[model samples]
Target chain A: MINKTINQKAWFMVLPVLALVAFNAIIPLMTVVNYSVQETFGDNLFFWEGLKWFEEVMRSERFHDALGRQLLFTLLILLIEVPLGVGIALTMPRQGIGVTICLVLMALPLLIPWNVVGAMWNIFALPDIGLLGKMLNGVGFDYNFTQNTFWAWATVVAMDVWHWTSLVVLLCYAGLRSIPDAYYQASKIDGATSWQVFRYIQLPKMKRVLTIALLLRLMDSFMIYTEPFVLTGGGPGNSTTFLSIDLVKVALGQFDLGPAAAMSIIYFLVVLLLCWVLYTLMMRNETN
Target chain B: MSSITLKSLRHSYLQNPQSEEDYALRKIDLTWRDGGAFALLGPSGCGKTTLLNLISGLLKPSEGQILFDDSDVTSLPPDQRNIAQVFQFPVVYDTMTVYDNLAFPLRNRKLPEAELDERVQRVAKMLSMQNQLKHRASGLTAADKQKISLGRGLVRSDVNVMMFDEPLTVIDPHLKWELRSQLMRLHQQVGFTMIYVTHDQTEALTFADEVVVMYEGQIVQIGTPEELFLKPRHTFVGHFIGSPGMNILPCDWNDGGAVFAGHQISLNGNLSNPASTSKLQLGIRPEFIRLASEGIPARIQRVDDVGRYRIIKAEVGGTSLNIYANEEVEIPSDSLHLDFDPDHTHVYCDGWIHEAKGQS
Candidate 1:
């Protein structure tokens, strides 16, 4: 073994990155922590609340309803988008000019700004003038979304699928493209049906990308606010109000900052915990 | 098992091919008997793999038909062709166990579970993979993965032809020789028609009974290993099949003999009505030329000692020539000469060997 010199100044190189992260994430997070444990009025006067807000937010029936609605929305979109995305990607052409055309078409929806997507669908699903709404009502169904809770939920879900399914399609397409041609040739020579080829060859190869698509859609659909807020404004009663929309109604709309801050922290923790659990589950299967 | 035949087969990747250069595989008409081990030997971009794919029905020929023992199969898909192809890379199913990977082809045909298990077990045993049958295929080594791919073909009972497209390319060098011999042994035991495509001369010459040498999308020659060495039908075969290749010398046809560097050299056969307009050259393997006391005079330029023999590079009238001499042979310092073995030397018109009269 050779004698090696250790430098004490090497740690200085990491200071800038730490400082940048502290300002961007850690400092803002600490303000939320500060608000969660205390109460404040318009004058910035504070009083120790001692976990009272956490208790209130945890026990609130409104919070439970919002959480349930968020979970259901995430589950619904994930069920619809992931399979639909994978199906579209599977049917896309694998080569030639058609590949370029299909890829560009898939990427079109993802290129729109999130708020623009929300605003565009808000008008696009209008009952009287919009093509989709007029056609639905014209086909002999009473499909007005402004006052109906079911139609409101349906419109929001459809808008989210239309705006976000393209992302999953592109991700799964990249994964599908990475597979070697030999696998397909071998499967063909093995006399596998199309379903068997998908089950044995395509699915296993797309697992990594599908995991990414799931996590992204799960988190995005959970924190969904812009599209549904613009489309239904949490509906005529509160049926469409998800966790973020509920938290916003409390924090900004109703000015209940203490409970709202606590709710925000809880929401962040839920997303983090859910993503961690899902990533661990997926990676565990991969290693085995 | 069936004898394969290709009748005027041609293929082009372009939708509208106007010239011969547009064809990836030029017109080919050939046949192979059942249970014959043949190798398509060529350098890269020589359409060996294209020919293999056309035979296996992965690609349909742009023109003409492919026959498996006199039945046209040009329009059939690869699955319906009843063929198996091991690719250049290992194509095992990663999520499957070794046993499942082998059983896949048989199970797809809905063979009874009892027969499927028996066939899988037989193939696993033959590949020496019986102990790893329960192991996941992705967890195995590269060579083991390749063996699993090969085992997949072996488990199928109805496969008429087993094609290999340079299956040893991804294998380690030490494992390559072992896998090659195992393939030869497997071919002998099963006695199926095997067509191996490769660019490596040693692999092709050793694995195949009759090596089909190809160049620029055309089959140059098809002959046994000894025949290729002794009598290469094309100049490309003479250059491609041997180590350090055969030596070619530009010559002129003078009085029915090849005149090379002011020396009249006799050929293996009699020349009849040679084309005066076509270019002519003399071809001889380095092994067939030796240092002589009385022949075409040459000056020794350099000597490469290849352990067993020394390749003597000499200059004759401004042209370079290579001769092989044994390690113990003495080299004359002054006035060195070289002699060509008439039985092995041949004259070529253009790129092809001239089919002179009185030859076998």
Candidate 2:
């Protein structure tokens, strides 16, 4: 049996982090819960309206549209990012100074702040001064992202792919590096074609990291707010108004705190539900 | 099964090798018989693995030809070579069931489902892995995982050769012996041309019918285990093939005998045209060094108990020689006399030994 010691000193080491987390997260969470089930007209006059805001949020068509848009965006991200990231990682060098250079370059976009990514892409996609827009216009093509709904949606998706595909690449690259060289040698001797090698060895070996990349990208894209907001400002008549933007418009812009708080809770639950389903599925697959 | 012939094979890692000095493997000429179990035995960095990689087609020799059954396949890739390799570490699909991992290669070829199942079951049963067929490979222990890797390689009988590169290095000690014996049985049942590479003497001696000892980027000797043990062609082979290794003492050749540290020992035969300038040494295995009453005087330094035998490390005329005796024998505390068996002793010049013309 292991000797058990209860010094309580390690708890002191974590006290500062606990205090910061309480201030940043727990207190605001309590306030949201308080506003979720109560009605406040003014001067903190609270009246009980149990389940009323939840019922309103459940029936809201705007909430449904936003949720649909979030799900579609996340699905598209997964469909594109996972395969493209693995492909790029496979083609990368296994060693030498080139590996270090490629790793550093792949990690640059992930290190940039989210809002800065938004602002940078905003300037770069403008129809007149933007490089891509001007180049397309120079070739006699109609490419105004801010005016057309289809173009706006395409621009947002493409921007997201450019911004976050590097994250998947870095993760997959780490996974690829962790595989022993012996596996490749074994595959070579197994008379495996290049496609067979990728399908059987590389892909199966990358399952764990791919799952993590999938979940992270799913959550991040579902909660996406900055890039599309900065690029089109949810213009072209709600074509790109994702759930986060719609939630913000309701809660802070329109000051419907009770219903917004209820919507926020519902949104949190949706994300949590999806995450739990994915986790359980992956864990079950692993166990079997 | 098919024979492999390597002709003037040379390999170099550098694009432009400076002169003939930068080659990792230099001008190797070897031919392996059909269904022969050959071992490339060498210390680390001795180009044994490089030669195996060339045979497996993972590497193309920089200068020469690799032929399988008289067909030139020097330019072929590994997939085109039709070979199976078990690596130093276990390589199995961790997410797949152990049975599925064994069945993967057969299924890849689109073999009939029944035959694939039969082959997987047969190989798993041979490896004693049938009981764990339904377990996910990730949850199994390392030895079981290695068995799965070996089974994956052995499941396909149509492959021309099966190459193993230090496949048992990671297994537990007791399990290593069991795995090596199982490998021998597998070889006997399925006569695939096998080339196993390892640095361990016991693994090489027990598993291979023909052991090719390599040193300094070249094969020094290729013979059976008994031949290598009885007559090692090179000093490195003599030093590498035995347990405590062959005891070597520097000697000066005189008339019909050599003087080793002021003690003149008569040789078995006369040397004709002996090396005039190079340094010479006398080599003998510990088992051949006889401990008796009338020979060169020696003092016992240390005794090591090796279960069934005891190793007597003693000094005779300022030269250290080890003698292997039965564990039940007792050493006298006073002076001791030692004599080497004339037929078993070897005379070395430079690094190669001068073999007697008519010796077996």
Candidate 3:
């Protein structure tokens, strides 16, 4: 019953953003696509080799190992950081001067640059010096991340948890603060225990923010390169060389542009698929 | 159901209150009989919610004691006090179904499943939500959510007092009447001591047997709805309760009673304390004033025809006053005068009404 006017001029308003996206994303992506489907040896000359690089990247053992490591690393950090961040957020004060102090402290880690975070952890987890490393060593633990595979994985995981758990904490803290005082007052009047209040009230209210925190952490941890690279540089016989590190090694380290381009597309697809699945699964129960 | 007695209950949000001005709730001494429906009526920031919170044990009083049928519950938390409160906005557990939301309080008490189910079912039926028991609480409309909140309170049998802090605020206009009547029927059926807090005079007067009018963190008056309508002890109640409110005219007190402008207005009786050195004013409701052929000289300024009646704005000696008349009453083009019914007119000293001799 309602008539909607169709105006073609609306496209003119979107032209600027469309052009910016083309320049920044679409054009660069086309170049990668061009390399992905062809063979390049030297000079500016390229030969048609359709699907050959894709097949090679898919069958490579190095690519599989890097992907497996990346998956494990992402899973481990998520499992550790989410619960830990929520716990820390729960303990943070809801009011007074303490709230500001706790918020500033939680935000300190997220404000640092990714490379700086990696570099700081690299020196901070060294066996001979650094507060954490020296204390662990003084407590009779052989903790040299530079040479040992187990210690290297431990240091990288710990460093990632330290550098990024604050993001989840800050998000969840905002979610907690958004809940009105009436909910708590009502729960108390309902004779609910502390655990029940957290389960029925706090947890349900924080679902949206927690989903955002998880998705952000999942994608960021999957594509992680700067922190682990600066800290360990995929050292100790490729134990910590994730997909991004392996891709860089192929594209820039060994100059295999075709396979690298193909692998980068696969990496991007994997991240996209994971994020899609996560978003769908988490949002399944929200009907409205 | 139990009687709730708040003995000299005072509250202050400040850690160290220096004076009476720092207190959010001043000295409040009140007692509600068992199974009584009471409404705390006030404007916003008038400490109505503070008083409700103090009684519900959501906030501790700065001083004084609270007794529920003779047992002191001042130190008890809300859970131990066995009091239930519905907030201004509905507070239903989003993840819980209607049945589960009603059963939450009983479950927290570790009641057996059989009794809990029975109680939840009874309350659900009372709220007319029996068919929606399986539906998620969050999916319901605002009115239904508020019903679930009230149902949660009603499910617990041992609740000493059920408090409502403007629970119908978010409800739709048509739904507010339905929910209010439903609450009245529920109160009759359950017989729980209920305290409803609101700034709305209609909600307060129609819902409660006794309405406690609060102003500036103090209980101004507590009386039946009829008593408040007929007689207001304080000028604030006279102004706050009625639509268009009572007209207060600055006057001088003399032996004839109260003198308004140059005319001596006859009051109900003589002021008990005539020697009190306080400023005097005459208080009379608009409905009690009539246009008479021979009375105080007045000029008709404006006439507003409401649905059932007409409000005539008149001026007596440069002071504005409102007079209500029947819609059929003929308006005089000129020589209009006003008459105040002696029985309904009272003299006010300062802000408090000076009770006439032989009148309670």
Best by DockQ: 3
Candidate 3 local accuracy as lDDT? 0.92
- Considering DockQ, which of the candidate structures 2 and 3 is the better prediction for this target? 3
- Return the interface RMSD of model 2: 1.9
Over A213-279, each residue of candidate 3 has an lDDT whose tens digit, in order, gives 9999999999999998899999888999999999999999999899999999999999999999999
Q: Local distance difference test, per candidate?
A: 0.90, 0.86, 0.92
Per residue, candidate 1 scores C-alpha lDDT tens digits across B306-339 of 8998888888888887888898899887569888
Off by over 4 Å in 3: A1-13, B273-276
- Model 2, B1-360: lDDT tens digits are 899998999999899888667988877889999999999999999998899888888887889999899889899988778788888888987767898888877777678999989989898888888899998888888789888887877888678888889988889998987888888888999888999999999889988889999987888999999999998888899999898899988988787677787778767766654677988899999999887888888899988889999999998777888889887766877568888888888888897887666754
DockQ of each: 0.79, 0.49, 0.89
| Residue B297 in candidate 1, Cα distance off native in Å | 3.8
Clashing pairs in 3: none
Off by over 4 Å in 2: A1-14, A41-45, B19-21, B93-157, B316-319, B356-360
Query: Which tens-of-lDDT digit does each residue in A1-288 have in candidate 1?
Result: 999999989999999999999999999999889989999888989888979999999999999999999999999999999999999999989988999999888888888887888788878878899888888999998998888988988888898899999999999999999999999999999998999889989999999999999999998998999888888889868999999999999999998888999999999999999999999999999999
Q: What are the runs in model 1 whose C-alpha is more than 4 Å off? A: A1-7, B299-302, B331-335
* Each model's chain A TM-score: 0.96, 0.92, 0.95
Docking class of 3: high
